[model samples]
Target: MAQIDWETLAGRVENAPSLLRLWDALEDYAQACRDVGCTEAECGLDLRRLPTYGGEWTGEYLFPIRDDGITIRSHDETHMLLDRERAEPRYVVVPRSAYNL
Candidate 1:
């Protein structure tokens, strides 16, 4: 069985007082989630192998968001997740010319 740190995640900084702190907290959680996919029952799929933004934009991230089955795209797309609880979908395009970036 894979190990998931519920402690560090329990007291997450979802709404910290500082911007840096918030980003740092978000980045931490993003990295952790990327490292270990969402095990939340809210996410029925196994996304423990998805990629998270590493504070860099060199490559692209093309993974599926478990909460609503929306495609998460990075790399020049600058995609964002909106109303994960909603069913409406958004588009994320990756240009063929991005390979050179």
Candidate 2:
């Protein structure tokens, strides 16, 4: 799995508070995976109907971990990023999808 830098992520979603919590959650999930001896690629955490942008939007956070990186995606038209460590969790905030449907 790939790793990411937290500072860079904090830059992108600095205004999105919920994403910060989501970031912490992702970290916990990653740690849990390590504790269980599961590969990050095989790990996932599905967040259903999470509130974002101060209730302006609500969507699911689909976290699919991979050997190369981890994706923090929303079921709606959005996504964000959070990082771990060297070459084990490179994160990327996938810009919001253009289509609503």
Candidate 3:
């Protein structure tokens, strides 16, 4: 797996227009990785392992977005979630098809 530069990612996220667009960029990157035959683990772009608020792992790619103290909701439809008020976030690009799963 490739090492992530948290500081760099924080900067990018801070400057990004929206989390959804950032997710798109990640999806593109993951596609490029697969084009070269890199596995999700080897490419270090597994969305399932992404970190979430309070130092928790997502376990799956899509989940819910809740307020600082509210409960998280799970949706059956495919989409990406973002929490800007929590600790700094880290993300990776996965194919769009990953969202359908």
TM-score of each: 0.31, 0.36, 0.32
Candidate 1 collision pairs = 37-47, 37-48
RMSD, one per candidate, in order: 11.8, 9.7, 12.5
**lDDT accuracy of residue 47 in candidate 1:** 26
Error of 1 at 11 (Å): 2.3
| lDDT, each prediction | 0.39, 0.44, 0.41
- Candidate 2 C-alpha lDDT tens digits along 1-101: 46644444333333335655555555555565677676444544333333344323444444444553443443223444533234554443444442222
Instruction: Summarize candidate 1's per-residue lDDT along 1-101 as a digit string, tens digits.
Output: 56756556434443344333433444455445557665332322222322233344443445444546554433223333221224422222333243322
Question: Which prediction has the highest TM-score against the true structure?
Answer: 2
| Total clashes for model 2 | 9
Backbone clash count for every predicted candidate, in the order shown: 2, 9, 1
**In model 3, which regions exceed 4 Å deviation?**
1-17, 46-101
**Native-vs-model 2 lDDT?**
0.44
Using lDDT, give the best candidate's number. Answer: 2
- Worst 10-residue stretch by lDDT in candidate 1? 76-85
Residue-pair clash count for candidate 1: 2
